[model samples]
Target: MKPHVVAAASLLLIALAATTAGAVTFNATDAASGTAGGQRFDQAVGLAYASQVLSNASTFIWSAFNQTSPADRKPVDAVTLVVADVGGAPAFASGDVITLSAPYVGNYSGDVKTEVTGVLYHEMAHVWQWDGQGQANGGLIEGIADFVRLKAGYAPGHWVKPGQGDRWDQGYDVTAWFLDYCDLLRPGFVAQLNAKMKDGYSDDFFAQILGKSVQQLWQDYKAKYE
Candidate 1:
């Protein structure tokens, strides 16, 4: 098996144990019950479906980070997905609760089901990912979430391809692109990097993991595709 797959299998026992006691449950609430988005969600994506997506996302992210034991991850008992009438951000994750925008749902075009699944995966990472106890870069945090989304095959058509972003930690899809390149250099790089961030973060993480500073790697990554 590949190194990350082997590591993932070894941690499966602990991950399974951590989940068996009903420690992880998901709830979906539509606060915009009468809106077009709510109706669309109900018809195309019901609460049960949303709950299943959230659960799957949790498992995927836990495995992604090699969070095999309780100590390796957060003790999240439950996650709630609320579809509400909101503006600005399409979705946001605060603790274990992910609030998705109803207006965005209503306004979105093409494959709402797939698009929503991607959003859930992105937000779900926040529920489990360590933030270096608030010392991690906010852009890195967001990028990690999108990295999970990218791995899940939900990368939208419009996202910049590999080596296209301006900077390594530019955030969102841009940073996700950079991190994907980093992961390619070392299988399980993302998982290892995330595990190290349980306490705090530093740019040195790139050098420690890949034997190169992030800036150097970014240049090399760009060169590879240019």
Candidate 2:
């Protein structure tokens, strides 16, 4: 296994212990009820985020979206589709809970045990990550969160390899792999960068971390993989 994968696996073992113990509490009634996948998230993420019961599916969507939206994430029934459609690519729709589709969650033909666990960790990172007040590039925002998931030991089986992609900021595993390289080059690079984004993303944040411009960093990152 790659070093990042090994590290992430170790981290997941530790986090899973804590996650299972109800360290993060959320309202249960707020989430989708009677849905198998929804229930899985309720036990895995919702219970971990807050100890409260999710009243129902609509409530769950509202609570997650409202937490992140500059405007209140009004309660809506429309989010049921979101919960059902978050496939291999997980994203926050309308700035609310990180939604993921099933394909992204697991091997289509295999048992979903590992896939769900890994995706949950990744999606949960999005829920908590700071996005530089929309000033940060969306790709970078996603990269950072995936980096956390990479660190947390929940990266998927397919993420075991890195490659040459369109750009370092192509997002998802592509950017995530670049961030892993940065972590190796500069320990705590991802953590420190995340702190910077919390204050509203700025290109200068790159200079602070690596003493290089963002463009320069992207170039270097791309070269490493290419």
Instruction: Give the top-scoring candidate (lDDT).
Output: 1
lDDT of 1: 0.85
Q: Give the TM-score of candidate 1.
A: 0.89
TM-score of 2: 0.59
Candidate 2: tens digits of C-alpha lDDT, residues 72-188: 322222211133434445434333344445333222444354454455445555555567777888888777656656665657776636755667677877788877876677786
Summarize candidate 1's per-residue lDDT along 1-226 as a digit string, tens digits.
9999998776552222112223687877777768988778777777777888898888888889988776677888888888888888989999888999888888889888889999999999988998888999888999999999999989988788877878888898999989988998898999998988998999999999999998999899989998
Itemize residue pairs with steric clashes in candidate 1. none
Q: In candidate 1, what residue range of length 10 has the lowest lDDT sum?
A: 13-22
My TM-score estimates for the predictions, one after another, are 0.89, 0.59
lDDT of each: 0.85, 0.52
RMSD from true fold, candidate 1: 11.6
